[model samples]
Target: MIKILKYTEYLYLAVAIASIYKIITLWGVAQQETYIFIFFAVISIAMFLFRRNYRRKFEKRKQDNQN
Candidate 1:
């Protein structure tokens, strides 16, 4: 379960990277689409950070309970 959580955190990062790439590629050709990608990239990065923090806290709490 912990491993799954870790993988999902990375998945969010991957999505953010992909969104950034799309934004760059479509910047000039499609302004509206680029904006959407930009929003996605921002949200993805935010989610990645949020999940990482939550995961760390969860691990710490688990460790504390064990010891």
Candidate 2:
């Protein structure tokens, strides 16, 4: 379960990276679409942070329970 959480956290980072690439590629060609990708990039980064924090807290709780 912890491994799964870790993978998903990185997956969000991957999405953010991809969104940034798309934004860069389409910045001038498709202004409206670039805006959408920008939004996605921001949300993906936010989710990545949120998930990481949650995972850390979960791991800490599990460790405490083991003692």
Candidate 3:
């Protein structure tokens, strides 16, 4: 579980960083490409946040089970 969480965190960070890079290079591109980069960034951050919340819930459940 810990390994998976760590991997997810890295993946999300990578996607976000990539999107920012894309935006910085979007000078000669069309508007649609810019939108796509923004969308990817938003979704990646949302997934990261949601997974973090879920992990807290899972930890709570584990604690309850141990008790």
Candidate 4:
């Protein structure tokens, strides 16, 4: 479970990247829809970065506790 949580960072990162690509592809086709995708992409990036930072801090605390 801990391992899965750790790896979810990668999943979020992937989704962010995919969202960016989708936005790029939709540039000319759907300007209005792009705004929603952009919002999601930005949120995904923030979540991915925050999760990675939080996980690192958690791991450090866990290691300190074990020692």
Candidate 5:
């Protein structure tokens, strides 16, 4: 479970980095590109939040099971 969480954290980090790169490179582009980058950034944030909640739930369940 911990291993799974660790991997998820890494994936979230990667998505964030990619979004940052996209925004940086597209900052000077047209509004359409800017909007697209923003969309990707939002999705990245949502993914991270979901992963965090999922890990927390998994940990709680594991503890409950052990008890």
Candidate 6:
């Protein structure tokens, strides 16, 4: 489960990167709508943040249990 959560964090980061790339490329063409990419980037960022927090909490709990 922890490994899966870690994978998801990376996935979100990847999505964010892809969204940024889309915005950059589209900006050059000036022919594509960017709201969808922006929305995806926002969602990806949020998910990554949430997962980071959750992972930290889990690590804290594990440390407490060990101590």
Among these predictions, the greatest lDDT belongs to 2
Assess the local accuracy of residue 38 in candidate 5 as a C-alpha lDDT between 0 and 100: 78
Better of 1 and 6 by TM-score: 1
Question: Per-model C-alpha lDDT, please?
Answer: 0.97, 0.99, 0.83, 0.89, 0.81, 0.88
Listed per model in order, the count of residue pairs whose N, CA or C atoms clash below 3 Å is 0, 0, 0, 0, 0, 0
Put down candidate 4 lDDT per residue, 1-67, tens digits, no spaces. 5588778988888888998998999989999988988988999899999988998898889999999
Model 5 clash number: 0
lDDT of 5 by residue, 1-67 (tens): 5888868876876877787788888888766887887787788778888888888898999999999
Looking at model 2, residue 22 earns an lDDT score of 100
Per residue, candidate 2 scores C-alpha lDDT tens digits across 1-67 of 9999999999999999999999999988999999999999999999999999999999999999999
Per-residue lDDT of 17-48 in model 3, one digit per residue for the tens? Answer: 89978977894676789889988998888888
lDDT measured at residue 28 in model 5 versus the true structure, 0 to 100: 82
Better of 5 and 6 by TM-score: 6
Candidate 5: which stretches are off by over 4 Å? none
- Could you give the C-alpha RMSD of every candidate to the true structure, in order shown? 0.4, 0.4, 1.7, 1.0, 1.8, 1.8
TM-score of each: 0.98, 0.98, 0.81, 0.91, 0.76, 0.83
lDDT of 6 by residue, 1-67 (tens): 7889889998999999999899878875664467778888999999999998999899889899999
Return whichever of 1 and 2 wins on lDDT. 2
Can you list the residue pairs that collide in candidate 6?
none
State the lDDT of candidate 1 residue by residue for 1-67, as single tens digits: 7899999999999999999999999988999999999999999999999999999999999999999
What lDDT, from 0 to 1, does candidate 2 have? 0.99
Name the regions of candidate 3 deviating beyond 4 angstroms: none
